[model samples]
Target: MSIPLDSPALALRAALHAALVADAALLALLGGPRIHDVPPAEADFPFVALGEAVVADWSTATEAGTEHALTLHVFSRSGGRAEAYAVAEAVAHALHDAPLALAGHRLANLRATTAEVRRESDGRTFHALVRFRAVTEPL
Candidate 1:
């Protein structure tokens, strides 16, 4: 069997990126910052980064699936947890139970699992960690 171009992790990230970018409410909170899978060395304040996705096999006799543990990071030099939390809330709202179009897989379900906001060591940036659980099967 050929491995699909869009792997489970890739598909999940793509779906999330699309969902977040299209959400006007999220954009309102983000103020048009970058949402990156691979963020550069110096991105401006209040940008988003798609963090690691851990995938494990979850195949059944009838269908093959993967369980994805995904994380989205929000960085804000806006100097408080409020803006970051607002953006995180928007992300959660956008991604919870979202119907995402995968290239080579079908998303069985997606749900927000956890979220936390914290101040960075530098004392200015706020980091919002948002995690999700997703199940997908081959299309």
Candidate 2:
């Protein structure tokens, strides 16, 4: 299909969202398909939510490209950080180096960059932040 010129950031975000929801490992970790771009209120525990994203110009002299730094958040209520970390691991494993079909863009590369698991200020919720770095070129 021919996709017209579009924002590479949005295209990549859509592709990432679709890929996360479709991963069996991530689904198993979350106990269901609970990945969301904007999670609903009263969402269940141990779910994944799309978080902050930063996109920057990566154009060359004759080529147009973009660099994306995206983050995914895992929320859990387990007694410890283990559950949150596990969910984060699943997310990283599912996304790193995985081939994703993006509209109006071609994925040059995607890689898990960093992760941090900590207890929320409420002291009951464990939050895991997983970040990824990706590059895309206009298709």
Candidate maximizing lDDT: 2
Pairs that collide, model 2: none
Candidate 2 residues lying further than 4 Å off, grouped into runs, are 1-5
- lDDT of candidate 2 over 19-93, digit per residue (tens): 888999889888889898888999988898888888888899999889999999999998899999999999999
How well is each residue in 5-111 modelled by candidate 1, as lDDT tens digits? 77877877887898888888888777774688877898866878899788899998887899999899989888678889988888889999999998888999999
Mark the 10 consecutive residues where model 2 has the least summed lDDT.
1-10
Strongest candidate by TM-score = 2
**Cα displacement (Å) at residue 24, model 1:** 0.7
Alpha-carbon lDDT of model 2? 0.90
TM-score of each: 0.92, 0.94
| C-alpha root-mean-square deviation, candidate 2 | 3.4
